[model samples]
Target: MELQRLRDVFRTALDLPADAPVDDLHYQDHEKWDSLAHMSLIAALEDEFDVMIDTEDVINMSSFGEATRILGKYGVDFNG
Candidate 1:
């Protein structure tokens, strides 16, 4: 599940590389992840996880690592 989430995040957030390092993800650290991309990312994540992320979380999600942590709060177990 974690791997799938990571992959989805990467595919949605273009700032990340094909093989992005999950431990070092950040939004402002890349060019492709602009405002539009972030919106797309949120949509993708919501569809993939089948959860409606809050607006605050959408704004606060600035990295893959941050996303993982935030989603975990919503019962997305990474251990899977």
Candidate 2:
């Protein structure tokens, strides 16, 4: 469920396939994930998890895997 939800955020951010691989995700890697899209992503993720992420985490969220790792620190167990 978490994975799917995370994917939904990515899909919305990048306008990419819903099932895009984690490794394929990157800032500016897609047309939709530019500066504005990055802010949108932070909002989307905060909304999805109901948790506030620090500015450091937002800056570090450059890829799907990185996002999963950062959220883990916020008590979000994506593996569960």
Candidate 3:
């Protein structure tokens, strides 16, 4: 559920299609995931997860999987 929500957030922020595979997405790799989109993604993630992401984590969140791991640090459980 949480994972799906994360994917949804990614889709919305990056303007990706519903079926777009976000798991392997990386910043700058996707045309839509520019610096502006990165900040938007961070804000969306913060709002969706109800957690404040720090600068280091923001910089570290270069990929979808990395974002999941960072959110885990904020107690956003991904395990079923």
Whose TM-score is greatest here?
A: 3
Please give the CA lDDT of all the candidate structures.
0.76, 0.84, 0.98
What is the per-residue lDDT of model 3 for residues 12-71, given as tens digits with 9 covering 90 to 100? 999999999999999999999999999999999999999999999999999999999999
Which regions of candidate 1 deviate over 4 angstroms?
13-17, 20-23
Off by over 4 Å in 3: none
Query: Given candidate 3, what's the lDDT at residue 29?
Result: 97
Q: If the candidates were sorted by their TM-score against the true structure, best first, what order would they fall in?
A: 3, 2, 1
Candidate 2 residue lDDT tens string, 1-80: 88778888878766677666645678877667888889988999999989899999999998888999999999888888
Error of 2 at 25 (Å): 0.8
Model 1 clashing residue pairs (backbone): none
* lDDT: worst 10-residue window of model 2: 14-23
Error of 2 at 21 (Å): 4.7
lDDT sort, best first: 3, 2, 1
